[model samples]
Target: MAIWQHGGMPSSKNTQFAVAVHVLTYLAGQVERGPVSSDELSASTNVNPVHVRRVLGPLREAGLVCSRPGVHGGWELATPAEEITLARVWRLLQGADPVLGLHGPNPDCPVGRGVQRSLAAIDGAVAEAVAAELERSTVQDILAREVQGACSVPGQA
Candidate 1:
């Protein structure tokens, strides 16, 4: 499960960000193969094909993936797998946003005046943590370790 799915507030739009990353990562590994259909992705994600298409657009715009039309058409990554890093993926999907945004406090209260500043500091810390983690990971790393582990059997081909 994702962090935001557990009731933790997300700085970015959760569904779009997750879906974009998932779709891009899926594409990154399949570059040598033919385009992957949205229906295939939909089945894996258990999401609607329309939803998958919608999420894929931004990635396409970011030059992460390219889509084809007509029969045997779908999507594939535009760049080499090793060239795509988690930070690139995150920026493509989530853009640059503090992990948490400060909400305005009650204006009449004295504490409210300082609350935004405090939240700004907290947001900075959250952004630093997120950046550090993202920097440490790449999409290829995620694919070789995380996704491969889930799909491959133990001591098997």
Candidate 2:
């Protein structure tokens, strides 16, 4: 389950950030294989096709990916895989949402108000740390790791 789904003050969005990364990494690997339909992407990510399409919208707008139409229609990377950093994807998808979901506690309760303020103060730092760590790697980095046997696929040994 995703953090957003937990009841700390749930977000309206689902796991778009993870889906975007998966879609981009998959596209990078399949670049020479031609466009991949949303069905294919969804199958690989084990996510709904509608959700995959929704995730693609922002990436398409940001020029990270492009799509085709008709019989062979689907998505491909618009930019080089190395140019698409995880930080970039995170910013495009998860930037606006807090690193930790925040709760709207009762204003009249002193303890609630104090806790909310304390948590809010640290949120920015936490978000920055996440982005910084993400910036150290790109989509190509992940692909290369997989190719070099440095990482394992979920279902394969």
Candidate 3:
């Protein structure tokens, strides 16, 4: 198997970002319905509930989600889904870093120095493109489509 296929290129950080997006999109649909338990989300994602809560901690601080405590308590979106764009989600999860951080080039070669600079520029452009694409999507958009698909079958909840 290729190194990337074996978990080479996309780091844990990227995975966490993706998970956060999925969780947020899921919660957006449940906003009007009611709070969703982390266990339920974990079951849907096939991940541990602890991991889900760990990731959700940041979103909560960002004011994207609100949690309650009680027998029926769980989490709900803090804001309207349409008002929360994917760009906002990415920013909340990834912070202000470039999507790709730079690594120091070989100090022994002039070419390496130049390549590092060029790569940094490319990374900046890629980050901008990513942000632009994310900005075009909202949690509402993803949830509306996905929830409908999941609920399409009769007797399926």
Query: lDDT: which candidate is best?
Result: 2
The ten-residue window of minimal lDDT in model 1 covers: 148-157
lDDT of 3 by residue, 57-142 (tens): 98899898898879989889898888888887787767656567565555667997899789879987887899899999888888
TM-score of 3: 0.76
lDDT of prediction 1:
0.70
Q: Could you tell me how far off, in angstroms, the CA of residue 48 lies in candidate 1 after the best superposition?
A: 1.4
TM-score of each: 0.74, 0.78, 0.76
Q: Which runs in model 2 stand beyond 4 Å of their true positions?
A: 1-8, 148-157
The local lDDT score (0 to 100) that residue 140 gets in candidate 1 is 74
lDDT of each residue in 17-115, candidate 1, tens digit only:
667667766666566677888887776666899999988887788787789999989888887767767766666666655677655455567897788
Ten residues in sequence with the least summed lDDT for candidate 3: 2-11
The clash number for model 1 is 0
Output the lDDT of residue 55, model 2: 89
Task: Rank candidates, TM-score, best first.
Answer: 2, 3, 1
Global lDDT of each model? 0.70, 0.83, 0.76
- Model 1 regions more than 4 Å off: 1-13, 96-98, 146-157
